[model samples]
Target: MLHRVRSKVYADFVPEFDATSVAKIKAAGGIILGKAVTTEFASSDPSPTRNPWNLEHTPGGSSSGSSAAVGGADGSGCAGSQTGGSTCRPAAYNGIVGVKATYGRISRYGWAPLSWSLDHVGILTRTVADGALMLTVLSGADDHDPGSLREPVPDFSAQMAEHDRPPRIGLVRQYYQDYATPEMWAHTEAVANLLAEAGAEVEEIPVRGGPPVNHSVRAADYGPRIRAGMEMGMIIPTSAYLKAQRLRRQFRADFSEMAAKVDVVMTPAMPAPAPRDLNTTGDAAFQVPWTAAGLPTVVVSTGLSELGMPMAVQFGGPWAQEGRVLGAAQWCERIAGLNQAPPNY
Candidate 1:
């Protein structure tokens, strides 16, 4: 029952016990929802699951099925992972709320490894408040995972308050503007303005140097859109891997110098709406840098594209600062006020 379908390679395999995430959810009185499909080995291959927003479009992957489940299923909440935008991207494509907290904040025991250094457990919920609640239940130390944080988990739901301070937002527009479609770029700008109007202290904080290139470099620089998860692990030389990690540290260091300045860094969730092609999942480019820096990031759906597809904006906060990030996102989500099911397209 725990098989990760791979053309009979793992068809007969079953786990001795539930994954830590599943066990925790059950402990919190969450009824098991059974398994949802991810891509084969949670990689490049697209799954049979269709986007609930538009049957012809992709829901995004390798968490595409999980995204579709949450965005489309009635009274559903889903969980997925992001080694590189797999969780949040799919959630945006399917028009739902996606939150990936700071790396190592959530335990990864029993999760099939894509990149242990980069993988993060993410949740897809319909509201930011729900995301905060789940983070509280799912966070804390795990002896099974050395990377799990040992710090006492805070009351995440309490952090959801709209209390005193207006958030200070940094507008990041480099890679995002370069890659985003025209409509998406304009939408992002408009949303930034809307947030500003709502009293957020928004400002253009354009970054110039030292972007996180290590994660993609380790993923073979993403030259070709293929699922090289396992291949990346076995084939790359130790020296190259070590060098990438070093550069990753530099990226994190450079960002930390500025992360303390902004309550949240804003960007479009994805370059464009879910593409019509099913051969590939939507791009992970926009989501990658934050994931690479291991910053807490969340995607809140803004509305639909002209083609009636969903669009969203991503809000990333300083490392280990999920509280501020999620709170700001909840404020923005309320101001946008455009949540809806897939329209009759």
Candidate 2:
């Protein structure tokens, strides 16, 4: 299924042809269910879709309806696009699984671009296994997309099932734990313990990256940071952009080295649960660094927060290593077993 924000375009605005990603789905015999509600241009502007857990809360964007439909009973699954945290954030909010495949892993030919450099085709599904299947089908190079990778697509389903031993998990705690709520911190620690008990090697690791992305400019507000980032993007000098790109490459190198030592890096998907207020999509701090590095990330519902909102943990692997991350998430999902329906569902 497809989902777009009403504010970004007219309800009847139809594209002339299917995006490469959507066409692939059709080739695989998958039906196009329908479009879900997205924020304007998949931006920070809120969409009409509300959290199923609580109508007053945000379902997240710009994949608001994509995640909502998966968590609730609307559709089998949906395709979501992310520039910042559009896909994973909503999946985290709605208590499902979302995968942000490596940049260029999936063709973005027909999808509307948010940031040409940052836009990534993401997958949202009810389980890690489901997400893996979708990724395998959606990934490939397209001549139309210059950024699409020419790398061979692996059998993710088979690889995800190949693990016989627990995988090593590196825990990034510096900024994630420091910025997260107390309850979130405790919950994350509990997950770590569970993983360790399952025979996985869980160790605290200091990330070489400068700082974890907090995105917020104030104590509890993220609006200023979001707007500021957009503003800076508009006026950013070409030289400055190049310098930033170089630094991003360095960060990716550093992270890949870390991933070489561990099967995956674990962090909170967000600093907190989905906010009750509808004025915003929750923070993207925890998901940004990985996204910026063009690494693959998958989020699985860990449990519920105090307000009964979904709290999720994200696992990131080296570029093109989505299968490892998905395997770890599948293991965690089985351990957590968080399959409860929303209160009003």
Candidate 3:
């Protein structure tokens, strides 16, 4: 397979070994369906992958091709990466479930780096159950990846149907309300009401921090070297990068303290439905903080926009609690009763 991070620099390049996740899948008798497209070096550049729901709209980027493939029904699941919402953003735009495992939860042995500290192996599937199953199969300790989790991988499939009565869902209504379109936000409130009437303990919550992606990935691991002589800007001081890392850890701690108050935290998966322009992917503001904090998050499509584009709700829990997040997401998905699929292609 070509190891081009969507750049011509390594157009003809082939890797000596499959990425850790790919190798794991292959060993488990999974098929290597061809590679999907990504943004240049998994950065902001928009890829050619179009939204399966609407050709004019974007299938959010970095993981654009993976999401488009699954959302269009060409594939059941795909592995994307997220530094700043690359995975869930595309999955939400495409009307599918996307899971970003906790930082170091899944080994990243051979992924082309966008940001070493922020990159995560992302899973996109038509259902939360499928996403959980993929997460189960792909998760484990890896000798090659120092960052790989040592925590035991449980049977996420078995945990799908298990929920402890009604969940205590902390809804981030006010913070996200400002970000999402009024229609979409109203729809979310309706969904929350629906869940509450159905027996969930729902309560509105507020958060303090905003986007931290601008301070992320001060040095793109292995990514910058491949780009070679591009004149981006002056090199950042190592001290600044360390400071960012420290702040990220503190943010994670703060987020965990807040998350401990509820079963899972909820928000609009995207600010709005997929935008029409292909020049840029949809906003990552909602998903960025979670990524930075190294938290596990899952998004489930709740309904369609007026234009028939997909709108989704994002669920997250404390770090290393993917099971909690996934379980809650599965419940929300069923309650929403929206099995969204793009128009036949």
What TM-score would every model get versus the actual structure?
Answer: 0.91, 0.92, 0.92
Reference-based lDDT, residue 15, model 1: 77
lDDT of 2 by residue, 227-277 (tens): 566666768688877777777778878877877778888998888899888
lDDT of 1 by residue, 7-67 (tens): 2334567878877877888899887665777776566778787999888999898887778
What C-alpha lDDT values do all the predictions have?
0.80, 0.83, 0.82
> Which regions in candidate 3 have their CA more than 4 angstroms from the true location?
1-4, 214-233
Model 2: what TM-score? 0.92
- Whole-model lDDT, candidate 3? 0.82
- Residue 309 displacement (Å), model 1: 0.4
Task: State in Å the error of residue 198, model 2.
Answer: 1.8
- The whole-model C-alpha lDDT of candidate 2 against the native structure comes to 0.83
How well does candidate 1 score on lDDT at residue 279? 80
Predicted candidate 3, C-alpha RMSD: 3.4
Please, what are the lDDT tens digits per residue for candidate 3 over residues 85-197?
98999988999999998998888899887777788889988998888888888999999988788988888777656752467899997668988899889878887888888
